[model samples]
Target: MKILVTGANGFIGSNFCKFLVSQQIFPRVFIRKNCDMSLFKQLVPEWKQLEYVYGDLRDKSSIRPAVRGVEYIFHIAGTIKGSSWIEFYEGNCLGTLNLIKICEEENPDIKRLVFTSSMVAGGPGTPESPQCEDTPSKPLENDWYGISKYYTECCSKKQTNKLPIVIIRPPMVIGPGDKISFDLFNIAKIGIKVFVSGTPRQFSMVHVEDLVKGIFLCGTHPKAIGETFNFAYDGTISYRDLHEVIATKLFHRKYGNLIPIPIPPPLFYFVGLILELVSKISHEPPFLNRPKAIQASASGQTMSNQKAKQILGWKPKFSKISALEHAGRWYQQQKWL
Candidate 1:
């Protein structure tokens, strides 16, 4: 079956394309004008079977050609930068709208559209709580990234009717080639000690490969259509255990001096402002952006993925340490650390 994958060069998209190719299926990729395809080249060497199209999700005319005659469209492309939320709306909300329009006009015969949504929309500190597929997302979610994803879901539900559409809400997706998790790895490698909030907060995570498997099944699984599936591990990890895992791997020994001091959110913002000013002058990003870190840490985040396993028969294979080890090795190979 022919399929179209947007952002095929991104971390998750590239991984999913590679998975499909390994299964002997060729999937066409739609990319934007300025996106670098070098990531695709290094990761997926069997490019002859992979079709490439240049289009912008913000432009209706540009998206039409890519949607033609495809059986499935995995809409995995979206913005995730914590700073500057306007870009998120344009890329995530408006971009999805354009693709949905194209699907209606060009590929009305498409089998399904599988959208990758974020778990942040469910709110922070959600572990130890039973979150079902039909739970209404708390409207008080503060993060801009989550807000953009929530709106994307709204737009998709409104405009989509030609084909069955399934939403995959994944938690802290972990695997190789992830820059966000690389931050934690880097700190461990350098033997730097830091403080973590001393609370028994659970964090949900999924291997990239497992997430890919879920996405592939979502396209064809009849039971998955029009359903929202949480694609996370069945279990959760605490902040203390998470830090210990990284420290042990990086330091070759157990180490902990974590100060659990809950600084006021406003004080955190004050520090962020100074860091932002310095970053602007130095032409470099701050270690932690004020708004993003405050939101992520302050609001505990976790979820359950029972629906994905039950509906799609998807099982994740990587543990937290295994994921960290794979990411560390990749960083060493790429000299990214």
Candidate 2:
């Protein structure tokens, strides 16, 4: 089937494209003007199969040709590490709206739109309560990423009454080509023992390969229409346990020496606010006081993939250990470490 994948040069999108090619399905890629295409070059040799169109999702005119004759649309483009909420809104929310408009006007035949969303949309501040698809998006204050994704889903649902829309909420996807997990790997390499709140919060995670498989299934599976699926691992692991897995795989170290410090949640917020204020003026990502840390340590962010497994016949093959091993090997190949 001919498909159109937006943000095809990014970590998850590029990996998804590679996975499609392995299955002998080379979808057309819609890349932004400034996105680096080096990753695409390294992965696919026969570039002819991977048709790329230079377009910005925020501009409806540029996106029209890309959707022509496309059977499915994997709308995955968005800005994550932004310095301001405006960037997140324009890049993610408005961009998604423009894509929906293009699909409505240019390609009415496109029957499926598989949107990739984050688990943060459900707000990852409480670990005790596991979030499901029906939960309202109680996004934390200043959580632009979560808010933007939530609005994207809302806009897509409003536009597509006849077409099928499947939203996949993936939690902390880690694999061979991810930059977010690379930070953890780098920290582990330095023998810097990672520390977290003593409160054992669960981290719902999935391998990139497994997430891509879930997306492909959602694009074609009849039961997936008008549904939101949490494509996380079947089981949830503690933050400390996750760190230990990373250390063991990358550094070959035992789980000891990892520090677990218990700090009040309010204190973390105060410090984060201070850092954010400074970052706002400096135009930089806060190094020490990012809000993501509080969510990571205090929030459970645990989700059950039972629905996906039972409905879509999706099973995640890579365990946390396997994911780390593969990530380490990929880092070595790229000389990232």
Candidate with maximal lDDT:
2
lDDT of 1 by residue, 234-255 (tens): 6677555665676676546555
Give each model's whole-structure lDDT: 0.74, 0.77
Residue range with the least summed lDDT across 10 consecutive positions in model 2? 284-293
The candidate scoring highest on TM-score is 2
Give all TM-scores, in the order shown: 0.88, 0.89
lDDT of 2 by residue, 1-337 (tens): 9999998888888889888998899899999777677766676565576788998987888999999999999988887766567888998898888887778788877779998888877776344567777777776666677788888877777765766788889888877667666766776666554445465777787888889999999999999889989888756777567667777777788775555444556666566668668867975445435446556544577776778988999988887678768877888789998
Q: lDDT value for candidate 2?
A: 0.77
Superposed on all Cα atoms, the candidates' RMSDs to the truth, in angstroms, are 2.9, 3.0
